[model samples]
Target: TITEICDRYPARIVDVGPKVAIIEMVGTESVLEEFIEEVRPTGIVEMIRTGVVSMGRGTRIHDTNFINRRALADAAAKADSGNGRIV
Candidate 1:
């Protein structure tokens, strides 16, 4: 049960779509097994399983667009550091 899994573990809710959410877990591997057990009988139309290859912690910037634009600008500024680029 996705709801039960959400209730049992610490997770982050990703906006996958209007009807679906990607529940990212931050707990032991055992919790994932439990989640599978709960969801199997729900008759939901779609479900996916994946393993986390790597993980990182900490906060993300609140203003994502602004941060992205700044990052792109910084990258552009450095692109011509050695052999100057035109326009």
Candidate 2:
């Protein structure tokens, strides 16, 4: 199962929607390759590599909650009006 695989690897399940799921994992190249191979049979539709985190460079946190809320509100409005466009 995916849960078991995640528990065994250095992976974390970030979100699971009705039709999609997002997972985050970090490790060496070999470890990542092995993990991917193990999960290839689980019907993965898409994979996106966002960015690399470096300890030497530290990390910057962005407060994007408000932006997400605004986007969600716009999407809801569009849906309610049957326009299919976010304004």
Q: Which ten residues in a row have the lowest lDDT in candidate 1?
A: 55-64
lDDT of each: 0.64, 0.80
Per-prediction backbone clash count:
2, 0
Distance from true location, Cα of 59 in model 1, Å: 17
Using Cα atoms with residue i matched to residue i, what is each candidate's TM-score against the true structure? 0.38, 0.56
lDDT of predicted model 2: 0.80
Q: Can you list the residue pairs that collide in candidate 1?
A: 1-38, 1-39
What are the runs in model 2 whose C-alpha is more than 4 Å off? 50-87
Reference-based TM-score, model 2: 0.56
Could you give candidate 1's per-residue lDDT for residues 16-53 as a string of tens digits? 56666666665567976776566557544656656567
> 78, model 1: CA deviation in Å?
41
> Largest lDDT belongs to which candidate?
2
TM-score of 1: 0.38
Writing each residue's lDDT as its tens digit, candidate 2 over 10-67 gives 9999998886678899888788889899999988898876456664332322555766
